[model samples]
Target: MNFLIISKYFYPQNRIASFRINAFAKYIRNAGHSVTVIAEGDHDMDTEWNGCKVSYVKNKIITESYLRDKIKRRKRWTVRRITASLLNRIFLDYNLFWGFRVFKKANKLFKENRYDVVLSSYMPISPHLAALNLQLAGHKFFWIADMRDEMSKHPYFSKKYKSAYIAIYERLFLKNADLVLSVSKPILDDFRKMHSSSNYLEVRNGYDYEEVYDVNFQSKFTMGYIGQFYDKIKPDNWFHAFSELISEGRIPKDSIIKIIGNNMKIKIPDNIINNVFEIESVPHDEAIRISTTEVDVLVMIHPLGRKGVYSGKIFDYLATNKPILALYDPDDVVGDLLRETRAGFTVKESDIEGIKSMILKCYSIWKNREVLPRDWNKIKQCRRFNQTKILLDYLSEHLPNQ
Candidate 1:
């Protein structure tokens, strides 16, 4: 089978969006299938990565350039705000311009080659827009629209100025997809609700478990949090809990909280200021190395009310084989996975006492040099290679004719 993957994010971009599709491309090609990737980049290039053919295409938004130039030249805040708002309403999404460019490129690619399947992943939504255009133009290949995150009903963008208009586009484009893939069950449920006639499946983000690292515990009990906090997924509650734990001396005074990323400014409590450390974002491989060897426990944060969000970092934490301290809604899929894998504890953001207790428990295990028992069998299933196999098996079973 020949696979054409269209994603706005791909290899060499140290982002969560790039990992899943990168894994898919590699493993699918390793399975003796031809895989070609069309990815967004600063410049166009035709190259091969991980045994898969790749075409990196440059993408630009005209309105964004115009807005920036106008704002810079005029220094008129009011005009800039109004113009941005008007443009947002007109475009519905900033990526629409890039989407059209991708559509044109995809059309040309289709004419030049025969593809058995086209898998388009989303975040900026340009890839899906391109694939949707191909479908509407009467292409007969099996199309899989992979949503790493939601679009129209995304929690962060739910109240955006053009959400309704975005929803209309989402429906029209996705309804034509032969199959819709999402990262979680709740997200697939939402898609099923929105497009009842379309087929939906869950293809989760996973870690590269094949890359192993030696575990070297930090001298002081350390807890590390990677990636930026977005929307309601702030670390304020966790910070408060840690402060209380330190004040009560429930945890060692030398215990450290290392935040690894270009996170938003956080007001550290006076008591815990000395205990907290911040590190700038590192390469993805280095981040994994730090997670595995430097930190005693890995921290994961999900918004209290959000469901179906398993931050891509969680899988990496799991691969580290270290205990996880996830501050998330106890009823969400994240909590469910943690419980099933016995990877770590899950405490709701509002449960300060619960959070403190979990912290102390993890601290105790580290202080005692005790290793937590994990479901290695279940953990193995979450590896990127295994996840890709599952996706391929599902595709084979469900779309056998293709």
Candidate 2:
């Protein structure tokens, strides 16, 4: 079978969305299916990766620098705001020409060799729009649209006002897709309610075991959080908990506490400074190398309303076989996974006491020179290959069983 995977981001992009697409393409190819990934990348950067072919789609407009320059050139703040708004309206999900370029490429690809399935993965929604374009152009392939983040429930964009226009594209993609999959069940449920006619599935972001690398275990009792941080997901509870522990003398003064990648941007209280360290963001491979081996405990921070979000980092942390201190919903999707794998502890976003308990507990174990014994039997189910196999089987079942 021939498959075309359309995603704005792909392998080497180092994002959660990219992990899923990269895994899908690699495993599908390994499963004896010919796979081609079409992603936003360097112009003419077509290459074979992990047993699959990759084609790049260059954006003619709406790049970060281009947008910044356009906005900066506007003298009036009001004019800048208006120009940005217009840009968003003109581009499909702020990716001007991405959809059109993909459509043209996909049209040609279909004309040359008809694909058994065309998987469109999204955050920007441009790839899905490309699939829609192909369908409208009368090139009907079995279209499967993968939603990394449920745009309908986007936090920043108000559904009633700001993203009303975005809703149109969302509805069209859902209505036209033969099957739609989201990374979590909550997202799947939301989509089912919105588009009952569309078949929905839960496709989680799994960690690639093949990419797992070794790192020498350090002696220091270290807790590391790898990934970008923003206002929505600051480890406030973790900080407060650590502060309390320090005051109580539970956590050693030499204990390592680091937040790698983007700055937390939250005001870090001076009390925790003795334990604090920050590393600039590294690429995905480097991050895994650091977190899986060096960090004694992995810290995962969940923002408000993350019930359905089983973060991609959790899978990586699980692969490490290290204890996780999840600052998340105690009973949410991520918390459930932690219990299932026997991976680590979960403290709610607001539970300072709970966070403190987990911190103290993990530190004791780390200090003892012991690692968390994970249930590999249960963990294997969440492996990238295994996850992709299930998805492919479903896709095969949906196809005419020849």
The candidate that achieves the highest TM-score relative to the unseen native structure: 1
Clashing pairs in 1: none
Q: What TM-score against the true fold does each predicted structure earn?
A: 0.91, 0.90
Q: Check candidate 2 and list the clashing pairs.
A: none
Q: What lDDT does each candidate get?
A: 0.82, 0.79
Which portions of model 1 miss their true places by more than 4 Å?
62-89, 211-215
Per-residue lDDT for 141-254 in model 2, tens only? 788999988775777565466567677788998899999988888888888888899998887888875533233456777889988676578877788888888888888867
lDDT of 1 by residue, 53-126 (tens): 88877755433335434543554465545654565666755566667777877788889888899999877667
Error of 1 at 84 (Å): 8.1
lDDT score at residue 326, model 2, on the 0-100 scale = 91
